[model samples]
Target: MNPVLSSSEVGVKINEWYKMIRQFSVPDAEILKAEVEQEIQRMEEDEYLLIYFSLMKFRHQLMLDYLEPVTTRIRPTIDELLEKIETSNKGISGLLSYYSLFFRGMYEFDKKQYMKAIYYYREAEKQLIHVPDEIERAEFHFKLAEAYYGMKQSHVSMHHVKQALDIYNQYELYKVRKVQCMFVISGNYIDFKRYEKSQPHLEKALELSRELNNKRLISSALYNLGTNFADSGDYEQAEVFMKQAVEITEKEKLTNLPHSLFSYAKILFKQGKMNEAIQVSKKGLSAALYQGDELFAKLQGYLKALYVDAVDQHGVNQTIEYLEKNKNYSYVEDIACETAAAYANSKEFETSYVYHQKMVETQTQIQRGECLYDF
Candidate 1:
């Protein structure tokens, strides 16, 4: 508590904090309190050291990142930790450096800057050189793999996921780690366009999630399975899985439920269930946009494509208004183009022509890497 503690005494205190932090639990709350309390003591005596402790707390919080996004304040704390990496108390130097690197890497992940996140995550892995906890090491490696996957580096992602799997298996954290890797791997398979290959992974993940009563993973696996089926035009199977995902996600208040709803709506749209598809698409688009994810393009396109079915069911006037409003949405130009053609077919030639012009303009701008929106 002294304002001007001797170097030797500070060294001893740092060692104590280091020991507690080094043994910090993964996805467990109790060990975090012990670590952060000692960290707070260090901060009380040394204002600058507070930077590193705060960053560590951020990382700890990320274990529950499935619940909340990382805070904006985490960014500058990382800046200070990296700035003071050198010429610090030797006892905490290595530990602080490790955290600085870990938090900085995660900051990139939070920003959706995937490649930069991978760079920082790799640096954190190297800094884990002296971290004795095998479970913690596994978690670091697992997160590195996730960053790589986000960057679409599939092979490297698999390698790190497997490494984490090994450690988790050794420490009997297999259920938790397995669900994480399996969900991503299932997604990777979808990325590769191997629908059949992806099913087993998703099914297994879902089964495990159910077995363990992990609603989040259960929802995730179901959603992935639904999407794969929908993308492959298996609407019947897709509907089943997607509804399951929606049920769980809504029950659990999962933020990504909109993504699931979008998938289901797309399949319904294709199946000519115009009313049902429109209802779901509107709800899904609302949630996706709320999270700042760009899903409107596809959702709007789905509604527009339903022009034919909408005319037969919901009426041409309503479909025309919807298409005109979202005529230039990105990401699904083909769908938008089809929508215009549908409008033209419905005898709304002038409105259809406007949609055609808008899609062309947006496509041209996108190809040139120019901003397409007025706002």
Candidate 2:
């Protein structure tokens, strides 16, 4: 409660605040954040501390953004912070430099720029020597795992997640991180087409989320479980889990409500519930549009076109073009293959050949470094 503190004391407080933010201790972090901000002004003479405070502030904002992504204020401030840190004339310490790269990777990750995120994360990994704390190293590994997983590098992701999980499992204060590690591990297994192997991790994640009373994690677990089931051709079971996920996300106004709805629509469609699928897709599209989620909006738009009366070939082509322009080769490849199979089933050999060609080209692009593992 002292209004004035020495530089070392302030450093201690800031480090404590960083821990709180990483743990998702919202209320405690907010209180400590204000305290640190106040104390920081009194020590403006310490340039290193100032840079450290700025970095932590950026990270705190990221934690807040994760909770309310639609209301994020990270864009302008992130660039400004990066500029300030890079332009500072004072010699940067090793730890400060490491944080600069690491946090920027997190910013890119938040934007869904997986390749860029991995680039920064890899650069930061080189500075791991500057970060002495074992737990901080675990944090870095966890972030790298997420970026790799996002880019579909399952083996690399599994490696990093296991590293992070090993450390996180040792700390009782890191239950949230443990849950996240479980999700990443499960997701990697799902991507490897080992659905049965993925289930136990998800089940454990679900159990831990419920014990923590964290709705966000609970909904995520349910949604991932639904996806696993859907991919395994168990639409009925997928529907049960996805519906619960949608209900929780919609009621709680979670950021992933649109994503849950999107998955639910696919599940319904796979089960031959055409009418319900159309309705759910429409709802997802509306949610994505409202949230200004251009990626999901475009995806839902394509699905809507496919679901409407006759297959809108032109619309499908236009959306595929958009996805390709955005470097979403995986999505384009998936859609193109599906379109090709559908046309083949309908005996439209010419159209099916065109789509098959498109799929092949996208796969080639994926293999040629135009996409996938771009780093």
Candidate 3:
């Protein structure tokens, strides 16, 4: 338990604490944080280990917030810690500089500043030459993949994820990250409508998740499988998988509940269960709102489609107003197309033409990789 007596002991303790703090709950992280801080203080002579422990503490807080979706507010303690890291001598250790950049990138990523996150990630990658640990390098690549994925650059994301996976495959301790990489790769395939290719990855992820007894990963695998089945027009299979995902998330109060509910609602809408879809969408919308405005924006698009089908022009107009107010460009193109069709169905030719043109313009902008709306 005495971390200061030996350098090797400190390294082992750091890794142990890192794994413990990675649990998906605030209370669990709090316990590990206390233990880590005690050990770090005892080893105050080791500045390098001190910085590494500090970064782990910051990462623990970030992971807790991400998993719970309680608040977007960054704690002042984290900011203070960053300031200390910045003021410290950089030549003390390359890991000090590497982790500083890495944590900054993660902070930007949490704020949805994907481009800024990528910039910091690149800077951190440059410092990786000093890092001899392949596991740490793979971790950086995994984070870069997530940043690119958020930017909707699927090809770039896939490339980084593949690199991470290749590294992870060489280490047993990185099996969890390997499963995560598979999930990201499957997501990229899904984005391209390659459902057949996506399925095997999800299946593998599901098997691995089960073996690891990771409920969150299990739910994620099930949810993605549901999306694949739905996209491929297999409503029965989609419903079964999505329902299971929903149940697991709701039971565990997982952060993925809102997304799973939205997917389930979409499947219901596609099956013409309009009332059921509306009910589920409403629940999902409320959950998304609790999570954050960004999540709310994504969930609203599905609800918009449901309203257009079941309600009236007024319902569709309401959805349009909501999206416009929020300025979530991610769905503007889809909303415009839906609005055009809804108007066309009601014989409002003038309105239909206007929205159809709007849809076309949005599509063109999206195709050109331009920022058409303020998302």
Candidate 4:
């Protein structure tokens, strides 16, 4: 068929190739892919459309093959896109919108809010409709999978991710995101405790993260690889990644360094070193409070538990006070509350009876929030 087409024809062919790529007829598809490239080359263009076509059309298969060592160059792509996307301008374009959503969504996923990240991905997917590009569509699907996987929905996430991989293999769009999807798939396996299943994905993610020189992705992939070892009780290997996480944070001055510290704390706790566990928990909480408010709260809960176990009543009281001040604590979350209840339990029977009655009233208020509002 016709490989080199005019501007209008190029648009038509992009959508056509996307459909063909999805259908998995690789040999027939490549002929058109080559033609599309030839046409893109012939045009006296200065826009990113051809490169976009190169990625969005084929998706990134051979592009993966050609990746040079990742360097500071890729960092500006992130920054420039971020600036344009602070508000919707025509210059950002539909294609770039897809990429921006992906970049930001991955950041959100790392932050552990799967729902909000998925919302960004949906926005990305919506913008993709205007471009009608195949490789980009596949990538969008893959990112959606990543978001879903972050939500702990593995099966559906796996299906979409494979669709991205299949299309990349077929059309040869092998950019960094393609590599990212591979790592994310491994993460799904890790989540399911299939450590053997995750090795290949982690291996590739590490390789590509280096090639991309993407510090954020490199640290993330390393963390996941280390997590697999940790999960299998391979503390030694876990230590390796946990160390990498720390190194990255120190170098980048990145605030989200709690995961590594917390992992280290758990390992110490398991070893029966209560002192080390308390120390690590405090360190993690210190960074987490300013860096990660949502997660810091949970880490503080653990810190409080450690205090109680260590028989530090004053420390436990302080932790409870902090949690209450934050308004992010649960009364039944830890033994501390039960311990307080026990203290009340040991008091005079009449005092215990009064406390028990307050519990009933509190339960009633909780069950009828609207009634409280009504009164």
Best by lDDT: 2
Candidate 1: global Cα-lDDT?
Answer: 0.63
Worst-scoring 10-residue span by lDDT in model 4 = 64-73
Candidate 1 residue lDDT tens string, 1-375: 436444445445544444333333233443544645654554436644554555555555444455422221222444555555544554454655677777788767765555567667766666687677676677677777777666445666778888887776665435756778787676667656788888898888888888877777788888888888876768898999889889887777665666677677777877888788788877877776766554343444445536434533233334334433533223334454656777787898887786688668656644443221124
Model 2, 217-283: lDDT tens digits are 8999999999889878888999999999999888777778777888899788767799989999989
**How does model 3 fare in lDDT?**
0.73
Query: Whole-model lDDT for model 4 versus the true structure?
Result: 0.60
Clash totals, every prediction? 0, 0, 0, 11
Best by TM-score: 2
TM-score of each: 0.64, 0.90, 0.77, 0.53
Q: How much lDDT does each candidate structure score?
A: 0.63, 0.84, 0.73, 0.60
Query: What order do candidates take by TM-score, descending?
Result: 2, 3, 1, 4
Residue 164 shift from truth in candidate 2, angstroms: 1.1
TM-score of 2: 0.90
Off by over 4 Å in 3: 1-12, 19-35, 45-49, 63-80, 83-93, 292-294, 301-375
- Ten contiguous residues minimizing lDDT sum, candidate 1: 67-76
Name model 4 segments beyond 4 Å from true: 1-111, 119-128, 168-175, 303-375
lDDT preference between candidates 2 and 4, better one: 2
